[model samples]
Target: MIFWAIFGYLLGSVPFGLVITRALGLGDLRQIGSGNIGATNVLRTGNKGAALATLLLDSGKGAIAVLLARHFGGETAAEMAGAAAFLGHCFPIWLRFKGGKGVATFLGTLIALCWPVGLIACATWAVTAAVTRISSLSALLAAALAPAFAWGLGRPDIAAAAAFMAVLIVIRHHANIRRLLAGTEPRIGRK
Candidate 1:
């Protein structure tokens, strides 16, 4: 379990947003909107391609960790790995432990843990984002719904993991939540 967690953390700590943006000479991603090392902030660079790559890579790290652990050590190891990956994305050591909110990693971990529940959460995020044009809101709603979705789908293990990640995501989004309540949160594609 510890080994899988360490493995997941190392993979998740790659900081793909910073990597992709810098690779494209877009300057330091940490200085961008939200100062977050995530796809949403990557999009602020006005490079959709870079943003998409960051999203895929961030999501891929979580998924890969879960899948690898599951294949080698079973469900418990997979769960530990997934949670560690999400934490790693949120507080990566390479970034002085200040990293992105774990939305993409959470989604990827959920998808690998249970596809049906994961699909439901993803669809919820898409629909919410489409209707509200608020990335943070979409993520919050999806993260909030994940545990319920997993419970409904009869995956308590997934529900537990989703619940844990949901709490972390909400904590990370404190500023976004305040801005949202103030009706001052930035919308998608505005940057």
Candidate 2:
């Protein structure tokens, strides 16, 4: 169990977004808009390919870790592994405890537990992003709706998992929330 948790964390902490961005001559993603190592910030570089890769890779890490845990440690282990992966992405040791907001990681975990829920969450993100053109807003709203969606689907465990992920995401976005309330939050594709 401990080994799985550690492995999940390490895997999650890989920071593929930073790596890919740097490798593509885009410099460090963390130095860009929002200064976050996430897909939204990666998009600030105007490198759509890099942003998409970051999104898919981050989500893939979460999904792969949970699936591995499920295969080797069963349901409970998988849940624990998912939680660990989310944490790893949020507070990666390699990034001096600063990491992404964990939205992609959350989606990955949801995918592992229930692909339908993951699909719904992804749709929520896409639609919200399209309508509002605010990535942070879209991510926050999608995460906030996840628990309710899980409950609606009659999955208490998944609901709990999503709730925890939502809380973590919200906490990570505390600064953004403040900016949002003050009408100072930057919109997507903007400085």
Candidate 3:
């Protein structure tokens, strides 16, 4: 279990978004708007391909870690590994304790627990983003809803995991929450 947790963390700590963006000559994504190192920030670089790749790779790492833990350990170990992956993405040592907001990582974890719930969460994000044009709001709402969705699906363990992920997401977005309330939060594709 310890080995799985450590391996998961190491896998999650990889800042693929920053690495890919920099490799593409975009420089540090952290220096850009919002200072976030996620697919959204990659999108800000006007490179849709890079943004998509970042999203896929980031989420893939989380899913792979959890799946490997499940294969090697068990359900409990997989859960622990999933949480480790999320934390690693949030406070990656390689990135000076700075990293993405963990949305993609959360999705990956959910997929590992239950693919249907993951699909629903992804749909929620896409619909919310399309309607509101606010990626942060979309993420916030999806994260908030994940636990309830998991419960409705009769997965208490997954519900608990989603609840924990939601809390982390909210905490990570404390600043964005303030900006949102103040009507100062920037919309997607708006500089």
Candidate achieving the largest TM-score: 1
Write model 2 residue lDDT over 1-191, tens digit each, in one string.
Answer: 89889988888887888999999999878888888998888888998889899999999889988999999999888888888888999999999988999999999889898888888998999999899887788889999999899899998898999999999999999998998899988888774
Per-prediction TM-score, please? 0.99, 0.96, 0.97
**Residue pairs with backbone atoms closer than 3 Å in model 1 (clashes):** none
All candidates' lDDT scores? 0.93, 0.89, 0.91
State in Å the error of residue 144, model 2.
1.1
Candidate 1 per-residue lDDT over residues 83-152, each given as its tens digit: 9999999999999999999999989988999989888998999999999999999999999999999999
Better of 1 and 3 by lDDT: 1
The alpha-carbon root-mean-square deviation between model 3 and the true structure, to one decimal in Å, is 0.9
What's the true lDDT of residue 73 in model 2?
Answer: 92
User: Model 3, stretches more than 4 Å misplaced?
Assistant: none
Error of 1 at 156 (Å): 0.8
Worst 10 residues of 3 by lDDT: 182-191
